[model samples]
Target: MNDEKEPQANPWMKSLLIWVGILLALVLFVSMFDSSSRQPDGTSIAYSEFLARVDEGTVKSAEIAGNVVSGKLTNDQSFKTYAPSDPQLVDRLTAKGVEFRAKPEEQASFWMILVYQSLPFLLILGIAFFVMRQMQKNAGSGAMGFGKSRAKMLTEKQGRVTFDDVAGIDEAREELEEIVQFLKDPSRFARLGGKIPKGALLVGSPGTGKTLLARAIAGEANVPFFTISGSDFVEMFVGVGASRVRDMFEQAKKNAPCIVFIDEIDAVGRHRGAGLGNGNDEREQTLNQLLVEMDGFDANEGIIIVAATNRPDVLDPALLRPGRFDRQVIVPKPDIEGREKILAVHMKKTPLAPDVNARVIARGTPGFSGADLANLVNEAALLAARKGKRLVAMSEFEEAKDKVMMGAERRSMIMTEDEKKATAYHEAGHALVSLYIPGCDPLHKVTIIPRGRALGVTWNLPDRDRYSMTMKQMKARLSLCFGGRIAEQLIYGADELNTGASNDIQQATDMARSMVMEYGMSEKLGWLRYRDNQDEVFLGHSVSRAQNMSEETARLIDSEVRRLVEEGEARAREVLTDNLDELHRLAGALLEYETLSGDESKRVIKGESIGRDDAAGRRAAQMDTAGSSIPKSRRPGGGWDAAPQGA
Candidate 1:
């Protein structure tokens, strides 16, 4: 995708040319001095033939040096030959009236001798220089540029992203708009004697559009934007990182009113004293330099430093204090309305079918970040294109959402009839239990089709965005988690239960323990929290990972967790036992259809048909009106092999 041309002076090709030139010079030097093996451009003959030519009176002239002979015949032809050590050869040549002389050996000049003597040393030095230059380039600094900053200045021509491109984080966008305004008209704030914020720290989970927001700020202000990763500042050398930090601030001062964004700042800004290493550690030194640069004696008036980190808890306190990072912008995951806005932004570039609804998709995706929504839109588009459709449809969006939330369907995995039936019953139990539970989420889907690592999945969709859980909801969730195992135990006997409930058991245990210890829901625990502090032990803090409670307290906590899980299991077993016929009906529907939507599942539990025969009739009508070219199951939600659904 990079259209830029390669540099003309390719290092690989340059090294090859250097070696070739050296070899050519060496060959030329050796050829100049060695005259014994040198041959003249003439016909070759034996030594006796040269003498015979002289005797026959055909010799005009001859030359000899180091046992090599060259001569011209009277007929004006040239000849050369190698001669043995013969004492009479010179006398014979003289007696035959053939003019002959001993030619001197060629010798190299002073410059050539000097070059030849120093060739190896020169080659070694050249290789060393080339290696050093490559190393410097890899370090992102040229030779003697070890202290130079690696921040790249982003320009408008490099795919400019304005405020219009950023969505879902409206509050964050509004917060940063003032900074952009300050950059455009600094006099506005200056006249009021109010200084613009020196820095802003964007705190958020991953994929929350923090970096995108930074770029949008630069685009809106129309000022220079210098961006670099925090890791780029640190190097193996202790002082290199600090030197780079100083150099970066110096560049920012030159480009006043520009935004300097350091992404993943936690890399260099982790708490210094918490590490095992001494104060001279490279990362700690870099953090120290950054602290001074942000809020030091020298006022960096127009330079605004914007940094992003997911782990703000681990950052150095000095870096996050006021005057350094004046504003801490929280870029949380988008809610329903925010998700709709984000989807609308991404959908602008995509060709959508009339049925495609952004609000519905947003509502379906409860906790999707802006990036997740964008990927969802992209995945929907990909699915439509894969199906040879010109525009993305609602069904494609639904399928794409399922893929993003759960995982891709593994229809290629072979399953026996009994396995499929067991999985259907297992998923049916979850769906049925959720429907009957008082505070449980709405049953969105139940499927026997394998997705991700699960043999079957029962999905629940919240009617509204939930920020916290209530006690009733927690108890209902525990029962829902145990539903699958309980159903298996009842139908196939307790001893024959499969390992499909392993994840469910683990989740149930964690939630119950969290309730008893962290949430303080256990009446016997007397509202006291029993959770342990989790620290970064690898960073040399909190070396001991042992529990904070006594053995008796630990035993009590375990018993409480087990009691909650058992109560949940008992509740699920009671519900399933009472509605045994309904469970069978739902499981049978799942086995027949392979997947069911929320409404269809409700219908099946109520002892009603899901009207699949009517859908088949519609497909048959389509086949009759059109031709046999279209496959029966090619559409997203058509035919026998329909994709799984969510609320």
Candidate 2:
């Protein structure tokens, strides 16, 4: 890629240039008028001296014009003087035998006179107009264009992205392909008595590529595309949003058979009167105009409206009705196969090593979306470049995945021996519990190294993509959550346990409560949902969503949640007590290695070594070669850096 230089002129420089031009024009106009009124340069004397000269007949030939007089002396020298209101001035010149001639007074041309009169008004008007233009530009549109549409027309010159460029979410893509087909050949649907869909609503979580799908439709149809955000229509003043909506539709009608994509429609299409107090009148009015444009009495045939939003629940019902948004397409997180395809698409741009397997990476990231896969590929390439590698290897991809999933490792943070010991035991407890539990996910890795905000982490991997959880799985997960606390309690006395398990305790409690209240998994709650649906913070207190259950029932709910938690804690303690030796062994291995993969952890629990002697020997050799200049505490086998050389 080539580097581009910045333009020579900046905004302030342009403003300065404009001011300079204005000043120059004012100077030129002033000079024109000044030159017309200025008196001729010549010798000047008083009116009395001029009269004496005229009486002496020294002024041979006097010339008079307006309020000044100029003539030549008898010696052929020129002189000038101001004349008073003397009626006999001309007669005196005549009697003096001065051969005077009275020239007609000079007058400006008609056009020059008009210019002198109107120059100041023109300058004022020009300045005012320029200032207004700058203000309107800052306000997003010109002064006369507040009501005009802000939708940007997209063309091939802007870089076209077609359906071929989109990957994953095939079902959503297939749903929209029909709209593209109709756009290309409206007669096919028309001949079959089928009317084209007025609009298609793309709903999904953020980063699911709803906007990308809209662009693909425009590219496939080969028609004009106008893109705008929902907030673009809204203004602080009332009626402006409505006018913009009308104007946007007008532009779309002028370019018939085009697509207009509104991103984040929930910004303007939120349900009216849902919140407490007065709603946003301007936003509501804009939404009303948008609704009318989509499905009102006027038939906007040949025009297609495509809108995307993550928060569809907050959108007004009128905007999502049959005619307005005829189809609702869901863009969900990609599954394993979809992930492979998405990774493949992004990997095409990256130089990959032979060991980089898209399938393996896809299986590891079960719930990744198209955007997430793209980011993963980018991060892998960046990691390879940072390491000065020619191509991205599988190890780089794995490291990138860890960074994206659990955050980068914080090796610079200092930890005491006691802290590392406690963290190792805590993570070991969770891993040991997961290994013993019936329905727990398989343990992937356990580490005592600080990462993100945690002192240690025990990661678990599901065998496949799981959409729902069984009651057994939920109970097992609850036990897994408490295992860290239970291990801490067993290693250190209950009173001596650290705050390492605070998050674990909170997560377990919430899960247990959700199982009872929301999932209706508890016998006490039966098969009915005890959770409130209304978002109180969103709707405010004026709208009541309080569950009408009695105080007794609330107390029962609390007791049930506590009972489930206690049961999980008891189960975790039982497992840890039975496998006390294995817990100690795993924790000791973590202290030695600082990290253990699933297989390594299993081997450690089984009383098998993972070949650490060779790595230790290599580190000792490097230290010896470096001599005694290095401090013993800061050596390879010292302090927190005591891990094996290449581990």
Candidate 3:
């Protein structure tokens, strides 16, 4: 896609050349009018000489008619005298230091007159050439841009991404297809009493193909597509944004039956009253104009508007109301099938091993979007190249997937023996806790080997996709998060707990807060959202409002969260304590294998009492628990505890 502005010539130099040419033409015209007439008596005097002779009085009453100077001269004794050559008169004039000369009128070349007249033209031409060279030197590439909009127009050939190029956004594509149809055949829809939708807004997270879908719409429509970012309308100058908006709409109207795609529309379409600075007013003005252009009474027909934004929540309500942006399509991360399709699309150019399965890759990358899949394919190709391989193997794809999803594997990373041991136990603690938590998903793999920025990773794969989360499931997950810290404290005492659980602590705390304040999971809080005062911004503000709860209630909330963590920790410590020997054995095995499969992990968790196959089967059976296996009382304790401290 050609999203960049086109190269331009120097404006000042071009203007200078034009002005110089005009000046030269005027100078040449004035010089051409200086023609001389010949006197009747056969001798011709130059126009300048004629004027001088009239002033000098060398011949009285002289009539210089045509090419001849025929006039009677006052003499000592003479009535009329005419001489073609006056040798004595010439000698007398020469003595007086006056020079008189005559030449044939034909000798005065028009070309010579033109050359003299064009002096200014020649100077200007030289100046214009010099100025052009100087402008080129200083202007670089972009200089003739005073009025032109810096929008890149991507034709179908340049943007090869059709609907087929996009993956993981099936619903969004289906919604957009209606717009495409309307553009291709508006009469069909109009015959059914359906007015073509003026605009469609694509909302999603970054890398979710919002912008890509817009391009696809343009390509599918097969019309002139004008693309500019929302930020392009906004400028420091007041009314600039509004003017750009007007100009953009005008351009779109001229190219009627075309698509206008704006990426990141939030730049100008933000809520009017939400911004903090002067620029907000201008942006709001631009947004208002856009709303009018999209749905105004006189708005042009067959002109479709497509805008993509990650933060649709922050957009002006007026902009999203019925007529302006009637349809909002959400392009979310691809599901398993979508992921598989996306992977296939990306891997078309990559040479994959025979064993490489798009389904397997898709299944593994649950949250990956189309862009991420493309990146993954490219990364795999690069990895294969780095390894001096002719084709990207399944293993290479796996490595690339891991690298993109999680950071690069730190195989040669230096860690002390104590650190390594701590990491192993910490990871084991997580796996063990998850194993015991009934509602927690089944373990996928556990590795103490450094990967990305982590010293270890414990991956849990959900049995199926889940869109909603229940309180019980949330609490179980929170408990699992605290398990690593708990195991560290139990085995290595207080000194064992480290920053390894920083992310875990944060995640667990947020969940607990949401449970108490937002979810109303607490007995006292009821179903009300305690923190209902929104920050006026989308998704709430970065900073929270002042605490509304009393000091006592605050303390209680803190105690509840702590109780939840401690309970989970205590459970982890107990599980590890019971399987202490197994934990050590597994840790030793991990050092050798660098990773452990779900079956191997289950075997280690079950200890020597069960065989590997039996352990796997038993673990699978345990996973069938309805919700969570932990008893209500023993459930990773954290909510408000009314009982006294040690009770």
Best candidate per TM-score, number?
Answer: 1
**Candidate 2 C-alpha lDDT tens digits along 1-647:** 12222343466676788788789879979899789878866788888999998888788887788778988899988889999789999888888787877777788899988988898888898798769768775444876688888999999877798988888889999999999999999999989899988999999988888999999999999999999999898888888999999998999999999999999999889999975536548888888889999999999989999999998889888888899999899999888888888888888889899999998899888777788888899999999999999999999998898888777889999988777766776788889999999999988888887778777888888888989999999999999987877776665554454455667778888899888878888886798877777655554554325477999988988999999998888898889888876776787788778888888888777777666643423332333343532333321121111111100
lDDT order, best first, reads 1, 2, 3
lDDT of 1 at 19: 73
Clashing pairs in 2: none
- Local error of candidate 3 at 156, Å? 2.4
* Whole-model lDDT values for every prediction: 0.82, 0.82, 0.69
Candidate 1: tens digits of C-alpha lDDT, residues 258-339: 9999999999999889878999898898998999989889998889999999999898888878899988999999999888
Q: Is candidate 2 or candidate 3 better by TM-score?
A: 2
Deviation in Å, model 2, residue 464 alpha carbon: 1.2
lDDT value, candidate 3, whole model: 0.69
Stretches of candidate 3 exceeding 4 Å from the true structure: 1-147, 277-280, 533-541, 604-647
TM-scores, all models, native as reference = 0.83, 0.78, 0.72
Task: Give candidate 1 misplaced runs (Cα > 4 Å).
Answer: 1-38, 41-67, 71-79, 82-139, 533-547, 614-647
Give the Å error, residue 610, model 1: 1.6
lDDT of 3 by residue, 333-428 (tens): 888888888888888888888989888878777777778888999999999999999888888888887788667888898888667666765776
Error of 3 at 527 (Å): 2.0
